[model samples]
Target chain A: MIQAVVILFSVLAIGGALALLLTRNVLYSAFFLLLTLLGVAALFVLSSADFLAVAQIMIYVGGVLVLIVFGVMLTHKTDPLNRSNQKPNAVLTNHRAWLWPVLLAGSMFAVLFQMLRQGNFVLLNRAAKYQTTVDTIGRQLMAEYLVPFEIAGVLLLVALVGAAYLAMPERN
Target chain B: METSTILIVAALLFSIGLAVVVVKRHAIVVLMGVELMLNAANLNLVAFSQYDPDRLQGQMMTLFVLVVAAAEAAVALAIVLQVYRHYRTVQLDEVNDLNN
Candidate 1:
């Protein structure tokens, strides 16, 4: 049952990512990213990191995806007439320089897959002891991980301020 | 599903993300690719956390990663907006003022 769910979401994630990569229209790519983020969130749930899964949805899907869409809308030069005309080629791109990235990512995956498939990786049995992660995460965030947690808070504040400053319109 | 299976899926996702970052010309699309890559790393951390179970260090790191990724995305998009303002275009190849 869980395995089926994992397979389903993984397919969703990978397939959506592929679509995101191949899509020409910047708006379409942003929408596809939302699909990919949701799939990753589901994958998190399947892995029993319930807290992480929720965070993924809230942060990635809710926050980041919206920001990306806003960037797309703000940056892309839109045409009201073209909108009505609906030309198929909204944003055409040349793929002539794809060889390097394909070779780089492909070789990296091949090496990692070969290593993982060698049966040398150590994996502990977590299902027997699996429990609600929220409590554990809460405690750790307050105790052992307190410093980093605080730092992350400060970082987020800085990012918030910085984004507002950067995106603000110029003064007269 | 085996741990190896999960890892392989992550690898595939990460590679596709790399491809997107490399191939895409639009800054926003490249940002999406970076997000995909970050999610792949987060998946690996969570999967390994499942294995350890004792410290749950991987889960903690994943939380930090989520925060950092959000921060990165926010700043990156801001920069993209600024780029668009300066260049009047978002195509990375065309925004080549630094090349000369």
Candidate 2:
């Protein structure tokens, strides 16, 4: 049962990711990206990392995707007939471009696969001992990783301010 | 059926992300590609966390990566909006005023 779920989630994630890359329209790509993120979150849950799964959904789906859609809206005027202009002919023209990504990704996967195959990665048994709940993560955040967490918060605040400053209308 | 399957998915996601970044001219599409890449990393982190029980470092790092991705998306989109306002187009090729 667990294996089936893992396979399902993996397919969803990889499929959604392919759709995101293949789509021509930026808006459609963003929507597909949401699906990809959701699928990855499901994968996290399947792996028993519940806290990461919830955080993925909340932060990526809720927050980041929303911002992306907003960016799409702010940048482009909605024209229903502009579909032709949105087609990905430019990207498809250069067949040679695909070569590098294929090679790099293939090599990396090969290396990682060999490493995993050699390593003793006991799955179900080890998952039983880990505490991957939200509370446990929260506790760790406040205890051992407190300083880094605080720094991240400060960084986010700075980013918010910077974004507002950049997007604000210029007044004469 | 196992960790290898998960890794395969992650690799596919990473490659697609690279393609999107390279092929797409729109800044938003590039941003989406970055998001996909980040998701791939998160998948690896969670998968590894499952294998090791003594440390939840991967999960915690995934959380931080999420926060960083959020911040990056927010700031990057704001920059895109600003660029559109200045030039009235988001096409990467046409928006080359800074090319010099």
Per-residue lDDT over A34-113 for candidate 2, one digit per residue giving the tens place of the 0 to 100 score: 88888898888877788788888888888998888888777776445655765642321112256776676667667766
The residue ranges of model 1 lying beyond 4 angstroms of the native Cα positions read A79-96, A124-129, B98-100
Residue pairs in steric clash, candidate 2?
none
Q: Write the per-residue lDDT of candidate 1 for residues A26-45, one digit (tens) a residue.
A: 77888888888888888787
Error of 2 at A98 (Å): 5.0
Clashes of 2: 0
Interface RMSD of each: 1.7, 3.0
Candidate 2 overall lDDT versus native: 0.77
lDDT tens per residue, model 2, B53-91: 545787888888888989898889888898888887887
Q: Model 1 chain A, poorest ten-residue lDDT window?
A: A121-130
CAPRI quality band, candidate 2: medium
